[model samples]
Target: MSTMGRAGQAPMVVVDGVRKAFHGVTVLDGISFEVAAGDVVAFIGSSGSGKTTLLRCIDLLEPIDAGRIVVAGEAMGWHQQPDGRWVRDSERELARKRQHLSMVAQGFHLFSHMTALENVMEGPLTVKRLPLPRARQLAQELLAKVGLADKAHARPSKLSGGQQQRVAIARALAMGPEVMLFDEPTSALDPELAGEVLATMRQLAAEGHTMLVVTHELAFAREVADVVLMFHEGRIVEQGPPQEIFTRPAHEATRRFLARVTGGVPQPTGSS
Candidate 1:
């Protein structure tokens, strides 16, 4: 399967001929797409359709069996050498590359012992080498941005699932990433909590963050995504603007998937 991605003013991510297999089971086969700067690309498909695995591959958490992923003009996990051969990039180099793209997984994954402010501060302090006072200030600002300034002193154990997820987002933003990747970030949350997380993500999209989200929320995808990719059997079967993809899907599998997710009632396309 192949897809020629829509053109953007600046292509922030380029994924080409990517393939991945797990213990002899293929999850992604020749996946290709481009995410432009400040664009939100939503990946939607049924369970086991390889949505999350694709995100993991882009983040370099899963080694691809073939092909390449490039973000912000830097190839992930591999580097082209002087002799024009691709070599596995050093661990240190890969770490540097990851700093450009932050990921939020399904779980909040905050440090249980640390307060929300401290959890957000840890990244800046440990990774970016900011001093305690500076990191504290920065953390507070990020929490405020996520509408969690008042919850700064609250521990993850004390916060609701929604608030903890927001804190996790703040922590990711603390690293000053050029792109953000979300792997079913709200899947573990209840409906109310998911709404809060979606609100946070909506705000991020409005603020011009480049995002690649794997989500089951068709509503959010229709409302916030500039582009939506419909995956099936380890390949993106259809992709286009939200309106075209949702209201006028080109593939039979996509129509069936939307029918299942939206309960035969798809919301009107364009803007939240």
Candidate 2:
């Protein structure tokens, strides 16, 4: 995909006409968007609207059939050959490119056996071959950033669900990714716990991290997103700043979906 933004600054993440499908059913149909550095872009819609699938495509967990995805000017999955033809990337090459991103799913995907600190440190230690002492130091700092410093020694089973997810976020941060992809990061948490996770995310956004979040939490999208995308039938039906999209949606599907989930208008009154 082509990069965007003012004069010299290229967009951090670019998805141009990307498409994905499963068994003849299209999940993402020629969806395109660009996220500038430090921008928070939220994908919101009803269930099965392809919100999460779009996140998967950006992270390269699901390959796109057509179009391109780029993060920090690095192309994913495919590369140019000497003859000018494009070819699918090798497993090793794909793995290397995927390292530029950090993905946090709705589910906490931590190693059950490792403590919170160890779980966070695993990536830097193994993937980057960082020294153990340096990795542990960074891991502790990230755990503190996520408000899980006190739970560093606790394993996944020992911590509450919210704390586990926080650890997952910390683990992702450990790798120092250029773009963070979150797919319903708080979907599995209760309201009280979800607030804790959202608070951490808000802090990250304020600190200038570029992020792509797929969420059903209208309040978070309204407050934290620089842009809101309404997905329908595998395409972005409408998108704009949160104010325009939430208060005066331009698309019928956007209006209907917002009305149904939000019970009317999706306005945030400072509560998550």
Candidate 3:
């Protein structure tokens, strides 16, 4: 795919003919897509459909076997040399590139010993080398943004699951990423608790943060996503706007998947 978007602007994220496998089993088969800045793209699929793996690959947590990924115009994980050979990017180079993007996985993964504020501040303070005062200020602002101002002093053990995930979102935001990746951010919570985290994510979407979400929350995907990708057996069998993909899916695989996940409840074209 061309690095330049249709309007000649560089796309925020690009995955071109990407393929990934584990041992001898294919996990992602020639996946390709582009995410424009500020767009919310949702990846929907059943378990083991390569959704989470794709997010991990984009974050460079896992390496792709083939194809390329470009984020904010910089190649991720690996780079081609003048000799026409592909080489893994140096650790320092990958680290530098990683600062441009952040991934919020299903697990909160917060520091058990730290307060919410401290957990959010850890990245800016350590990785970005921000001053203590500035880092604290940023963390506080983020906590408040995620509706956790009062929970700032609370440790992970003291906060609810939803609150912890919100803190994780805040921590991801603290890095000032160009793109945010969420791997089923609400999966671990009960519906009521998941609603809280989903609300924060909706707020982020409203604020125009570019996001790539792999979620089972069809409601969120239909309402919030600018584009929906339906993954089947490691490939995107169907992709389109929420209206097309949810209400009138073009592929039989998509229709069946939606039927099973949505429990045959008709999907509305827009948010409830």
Q: In model 2, what are the clashing residue pairs, if there are any?
A: none
TM-score of each: 0.94, 0.95, 0.95
lDDT of 2 by residue, 81-107 (tens): 999998888998887888889999899
TM-score of 1: 0.94
Candidate 1 lDDT trough over 10 residues, lowest sum: 1-10
Error of 3 at 120 (Å): 0.5
lDDT of 3 at 134: 100
* Global Cα lDDT for candidate 2: 0.88
Candidate numbers, best lDDT first, in rank order: 3, 1, 2
Can you tell me which runs of candidate 3 are displaced by over 4 Å?
A: 1-6, 80-85, 269-272
Report lDDT (CA) for all predictions.
0.90, 0.88, 0.91
1-272 in candidate 3: lDDT tens per residue?
A: 33224475678999999999999899999999888898899999899999999999999999999999999988999878999997899998898999989999999898999999999999999999999999999999999999999999999999999999999999999999999999999999999999999999999999999999999999899889988888999998888888878878888988888889989887766455
